[model samples]
Target: MKKATRLLTPALGVGLVFGAMGVSAQSETVTVESGDTYWGIAQGFDGVTTEDLVEANEYNPRAIPIGAEIKIPDGETSSDNDVVTHVIQPGNTLTNIAAVYDGVTVDDLFRLNPGIDPYSLTVGSEIVVVDYNSEFGEDYLYHTVQPGNTFNEIASVYDGVTVDDLLEANPNEDPYELTIGSRIVIPLN
Candidate 1:
């Protein structure tokens, strides 16, 4: 019976690894800092909801000693160069602002402007539109497309732009009929 139990222990552990729990079997260790709780640390990671954290803890909940290493999902690395400042317009809503920029969501805008209430659009307040790593150009108002340019290509030249975002900006113009020297509205970062 002792021999059987010993063999079952490793198998049970492996079974837990492959269980219904959504946590990755391969996890990286994060050190618990002062005032860091499992809930707070878990919330920091994307794709990790509260339930996932609870499930992950079931494996070794008691092991999370203060200053102990705990497994956490990966987090995004912030780039100082990616910051783009934009002045809030009178008619602008948080969602509309997010739609104007590529790779950005309303939640992202809210996160960047911590003190600004989402419900209240404070005109003239500068907000970071997109998180990227690129420099801004001097020509702020517009950009004219040159020959051999696609929506994707144009987006690549500017910071915080995507093909879809460019298309959204120019509702009247056809994406297929992008002519050279045609002016397109560049969304302010």
Candidate 2:
């Protein structure tokens, strides 16, 4: 029974990996820290929703585990850099701001900016928008920790990535227990 139970985990994990690969979208994982909220974490990037963060980590919004890595999905983006930092200015509407980018939207502004109200925009607040499929940019991505995540578990989903790679990439993180919603770098294949 113990053997079967152990095998089931890996089997299901493989299925998940394959299933994820079948989709057109890919994800980066990140670790959660103390006092971090879904709303706060989602604010760090453009187009990342609190619901998406919750769904990816598979945790309750109220009680997310510290050290768990969460997956942040990327949409259509392209740039030489992983992200473009845009400062919110006076007279900026979320729709108008998002209109400047192909995949960005008013919802994206809300997702990436939790404290600020769309109706009353704040000037000088920085918002980060991620660029997907950027040419010759940072190969590794920043991943958020979610429940039931380990270096091995995360690596199992990606092609040609390993626990050792994760360790090497993120020497600061404890390999045994990753911090939930904390940032971990994932090396690309």
Each candidate: what lDDT?
Answer: 0.55, 0.60
Any runs in candidate 1 off by more than 4 Å, and if so which?
1-81, 133-189
Over 43-141, each residue of candidate 2 has an lDDT whose tens digit, in order, gives: 676876553454344454556688876666452332233454455667767776665443456665565566766777668775654333342246877
Highest TM-score among the candidates is held by which one? 2
Q: What TM-score does each of the candidates earn?
A: 0.29, 0.32
* lDDT (tens digit, per residue) of candidate 1 on 22-78: 543455555656555444555556754322333233222323456565644333322
- Which numbered prediction scores highest in lDDT against the true structure? 2
**Which regions of candidate 2 deviate over 4 angstroms?**
1-137
Error of 2 at 164 (Å): 0.5
Q: Which 10 consecutive residues of model 1 have the lowest summed lDDT?
A: 1-10
